[model samples]
Target: MTVTVESRPTGHPGYSQTLPREPESAAIARKLVRTALAAWYLEDLVEDAETVITELVSNAVDHARLESIRVVVTRPTEKLVRFGVVDRSRNVPYMRTDSNGDNTRGRGLLLVDALTDRWGTDRYRWGKQVWGEMKCD
Candidate 1:
């Protein structure tokens, strides 16, 4: 995946890192989210944010046939925390409800959309980013 480090105009304190696109990377992504949140003293957001991160990273590892994927964490302000997963796959992430309620899969985006205050995707020339925000206030 082509990842550019150029920061946008959000002006928030944030972090971004790339990892091999594999099942193991999901655990690493969770660890990164936990560590980053701890460093920022945003323990309140840890549980939910980690869950969201894991879902996003796992989806990338499962679907995106890329060398690597990127995870980004940022706080636009003290009241909100944002995270995104970037992958080279052009497929857009969307929430879906399965008719079979017992289905374990296909619920990743559903949980993400349900938990986050707001979530969406941003497409670039090479890929797209699935992002969500958790409100701290």
Candidate 2:
């Protein structure tokens, strides 16, 4: 996967990092979300944000056949922070309901969509970015 460092916000402080596309990276992603929220304006919702980020990153790493992952945290203002993960797979993430009593899988996007204030995906040339915004106010 291609890792690119985009310019930070002109005034708002934020962070971006490249991580290996693996399940282990989920823990690191959670930490990154917690740190970003603490450093930005979403401290009150850091726990929820961390949980959402961890699930999304874990799903991407486990499902998307990508070599690397890119995570970006940006505070567009003081009320909200956006956390996103971009991978190198073209498959779009989806949320599915489990009806066969199987609880071992297929709930990441559902949890993310249910938890975040707003979330969506943007398609890239080679992959897509699944992003969510958590509100602090």
Error of 2 at 25 (Å): 0.8
Q: Residue 106, candidate 1: how far off, in angstroms?
A: 1.1
- Model 1 bad stretches (over 4 Å): 1-13, 100-102
Candidate 1 global CA lDDT score:
0.83
Candidate 2: segments with Cα more than 4 A from true spot = 1-13
- Candidate 2 on 10-115: residue-level lDDT in tens? 2245777889988888888878878776655457787788888888788788867768898878776656678889888888887777654856677778888888
The residue pairs that clash in candidate 1, if any, are none
TM-score of 2: 0.83
> What tens digits encode model 1's per-residue C-alpha lDDT throughout 1-137?
99886432342557788999987887888788887777777787888898899899988988886789999988787677788999999999767766567778878988898789998899999999999998866
Give the winner by lDDT: 1
lDDT for model 2: 0.78
Q: Give me the displacement of residue 96 in model 1, in angstroms.
A: 1.1
